[model samples]
Target: MVTWLGAPSVAALREALHEVAPQLGGGAIVPRNLVPDAAPEWSAATAVLAGRYVVKFAWAEPAALRIRHQVRVLGALKVSAPWLALPAVVVASESPALLVTELAAAVPFFDVRHLVGAGGRARVAQDLGAVLARLHDPDVLAAVSAAAGPLAAPVMPAATDALRRGPAAPAPDARWERVAAWCDWTDRVLGPAPGRSGLVHGDFHGGNHLWDERSLRLELVVDWETAGPAEPEYDLRCLPGDCGMELFGAVVDAYERVSGAALDRDRIMGWHVRTVLDDVLWRVEAGVPMPDRRTAGEWVDDLGARLAGFGVGG
Candidate 1:
């Protein structure tokens, strides 16, 4: 498993660039930090090289395998979905833990400071729906699996362990009890369904999506480090409340229209709730402060309200 210690200093990065220059198709490479200064230890600090390529060095040998997996997935996509704008794999190395790819001319949809009008929002929803449709397609999944080997094990166990390691004890507050109950509910309801699995971009929220401001389209999808096989709902979970329920509905409607299948509302809702709880657990374990010091009851209430709006309920 990868453990973060600290980012390499400018000098260290410079030495790394010097070493890898030959593999990069050689130029006077300039390194720019892809990670923000405030990011936590779990995230890797990537570098943009020569203004055209992005390079990420893993923290450990195990992490290097993860990068290799992503590279294979990208290579497979290059053949299966040529229309999708994804980074082209430039170089991958197991030793010294490196993966490099060409940079796409796009920005995460969340980073767009300018307001998008209703038309723009609809377009974004439709684009996402269609791409997600492709990702979940049976044909695409088979092709990617054949090319990249099977997706790795699910990440939930590690997440659960992290949550349990938090310092908070049950006696101090009823919040732990509430959290326990939520976990119990999730276990009973959210187990994966056989034959329902598909290719999932493990983190498919707006923050990971890159929008082409000039073309007004989703030109590229970035951060495939966690791509795998999972229920289709894993990708849709974060999208259900984006913009507003209306836009969420637009995404769902478009997805149904494109895929010729009804959205699995129950499963999606269950995964969304579990995802929210997992996020809270991760934050707590990381020693990061929670918003309003969120309690279990409050989280449940919020979940209830959000689901009700989508015509789903306990």
Candidate 2:
């Protein structure tokens, strides 16, 4: 019984917001794409309303589905994990796939990068670890599952096609061989299915988190579209690459202490390996530019270095 509204331009979004919540529609509507580099026509978009609230809407069907899913997930978490610093949902609509939330005065982790020292980093890591522990708790997961229905499975890398296609352009045979060998090693390391699974913030990355400036406390976690069930390590996959191995270790240490559970380091490394190569494969095949314009071989070599840091020979 939902009426679909096609992708909305700034004006269209304003109109929809006005229709549902007139208080939010009068302010200046500055559009921001939720997905980086995506066009307004096909991307999920957000707009800041008078610096007090944010209105999110989808332009495409997939984006719309995710928006609806996020609303449900957030509602479930509100009851299950009330103490978590999550955004306050002001209002939402299914027909237009729009969501409105009160904007918090917080910034992404990277925004406060200069303020963090070794001690500061460890504190942040500990806070993150504790949060993850709660999110992964059996009680919370059960509550989320009961309210949100089934959670999505972990997304493993589909490197076979990319391996067959080789690099975007012809590379030295050694590069191809190295890539293939690394993939094989990862497969062997990953081996069988993971013994532990939990509800994970499917896209838990630095950018998705917001922190209070004065306290450096995690203020809010945005973008719940990808939250689901998966190997807990999958949530930690970006820590090594994004925050460096030291912080990665710190987070793991704190996580162990808080959760009172030992994590399998090899499994964590295996997930990291898959995550890095998945990025390389996607960019190579889609002709998207790699970060810093680095060549595929260089990217692969970097992955090897990261693996070696974990005492895993690639």
Candidate 3:
């Protein structure tokens, strides 16, 4: 659902069409591969049929639960956020573990280059802030949770433990120690959940949204498989890094303005650190090439410095 690369083999495509085509209703549903070149190994192949419908199958058997949950999330969002353009489900199945949806023609927000310019960046930031505000509205969050049920809880401390104990990286580094320290900081600072929570798009980075560059509007918020109830700022961590501090501030200001809630910089920073730690541990365990190790270390170091400046960390 985020994005994908690579192509399915002839035999694989045939099997998928045979299994999925029938359930999608009557039409000439010719399948076209949609994965981009240079996709990550874990990326799944997506097929667009008849240029109007999209068929996304899980790359592995383990993804079935998330795919099914995405169907429910989209269904709920359709009713809850009518103005937002989202893919409507045509058919969903467990055996092939595929979800068919109406095709949406738009560029992923991450791919849009307009944000490099000052004026365009500010506009996009404000627009995105407003959209996030709408999605995180208390009533909307309640409705989405009621429809989709509780989502998986944050895998923070467990991920920290894994990083410390996992065989691939058994030797704990200073960065790992910082991660553990931050986890403790988070616990102390956000003790017993201060009652400010809402729907969180667990993997809500820019890559998960589609944007219309021309209109400067959000076309869709895709990849709802990770969505669930959590702290309101959980989704803020998704903002792309290309945006300068000025633009980032504009986004937070707009978000607070639209949502009528003050943004918590400390909590947001904590969540961001937790996510980075979790990702590093997952990659180490999975044997995937770790991404920008030095950059990640620098980021955490800077985060610790920031927290220390604010008297949240020693």
Candidate 4:
């Protein structure tokens, strides 16, 4: 059992890395917290070693387990999908739960999301679709499951429950009628049966990808802590809402071309609804201010606009 090591300072993490992998000892270690808004005690922290590699270390036990699982998942993918542009794991330590990987030579997807033109977006979308198709291949999923054990499946209804119980729960007022209507729409659309399932990057979003601006391609996918079994649509949930429907449609088209299978657009939209509302619910519950200090109602309005972009909601 790994002991909880409380949150580590840059100096502490550097020392731990040195003790475990002495060859990596000499470097200018810069601390980067993956989730800056997280509680200090449970911050997801990493140390950049000499600008060439990143050392992921966990401060809490739960975080340690996730790191270990990610190490296993990556190890399996290294063999099953060697061509994938994943960060190569250099070393992993069990005691202090440290995972060292090569730093990807690209920028976060967010950096180029709005900067890219239509052609660039199409190229990126195509690449993303092909990558996800390969990742969700049946043989690759089998290999990952064998190595990493059973992965968690996404629960679609949980988002609705969260909104109903969270601080954003609708009250008997016209201002919140939109929220109530959204909940009803989700219930009516999602139905009783679950959608098709496959291996998914459970937390797939712009922030988790590395993009090559010159090539207009995805260089690498990082932060696989939440990778597991779910509907393939789960991975594409953020695209339409965050990046726009055109890019999302391009990705789906590319995916169908590469995988020889058509995707259900409605199913994708259903997951999109869950993803958008879940974001709103979490921010309101945690008292985290939205972008532009927008009110929760305004965020809901944005969600409605995103749905309308897909020609779905009002």
Candidate with top lDDT is 2
lDDT of 3 by residue, 1-314 (tens): 32211144434544565666654444444545434342343334566666687776654433456676677778888888776656667776655556777787777876774454766766777777888787778888778777767666433424434534433644234555656567777655555564576776677776677888777677887777677777777777545243434566678888988888897866665566566556656555655554445444565565566556546654
Across residues 62-167, which tens digit of lDDT does each residue of candidate 1 receive?
Answer: 4556666677788888898787668777776544456677888788776662456776777877898898877888788788889878877346423333443433
Q: What's the residue-level lDDT of 309 in candidate 1?
A: 82
Stretches of model 1 off by over 4 angstroms after superposition:
1-12, 23-43, 157-195, 241-243, 289-304, 311-314
Model 4: CA > 4 A from native: 1-6, 34-42, 154-157, 165-176, 291-297
lDDT of 4 by residue, 144-184 (tens): 88877887764443566665554644422343456555666
Candidate 2 error regions (>4 Å): 1-4, 34-42, 160-165, 168-177, 291-298
**Candidate 2, lDDT over the whole model:** 0.77
TM-score, each model? 0.77, 0.88, 0.73, 0.88
Error of 2 at 292 (Å): 6.0
- Looking at model 4, the pairs that clash are none
Best-to-worst ranking by lDDT: 2, 4, 1, 3
Cα lDDT tens digits for candidate 2, 1-314: 23334545777777788788888888898777545446543468788988889888876776777788788889999999998879999987777788899988999876875576786988888888888877888778789989988877645666544653565645523555656666676677678888677888887777888998988888888988888888787788877776678778888899999999887767777777777777777677677777658787787787778877776664
Each candidate structure's count of clashing pairs: 0, 0, 0, 0
Q: Which lDDT value does model 3 have at 25?
A: 41
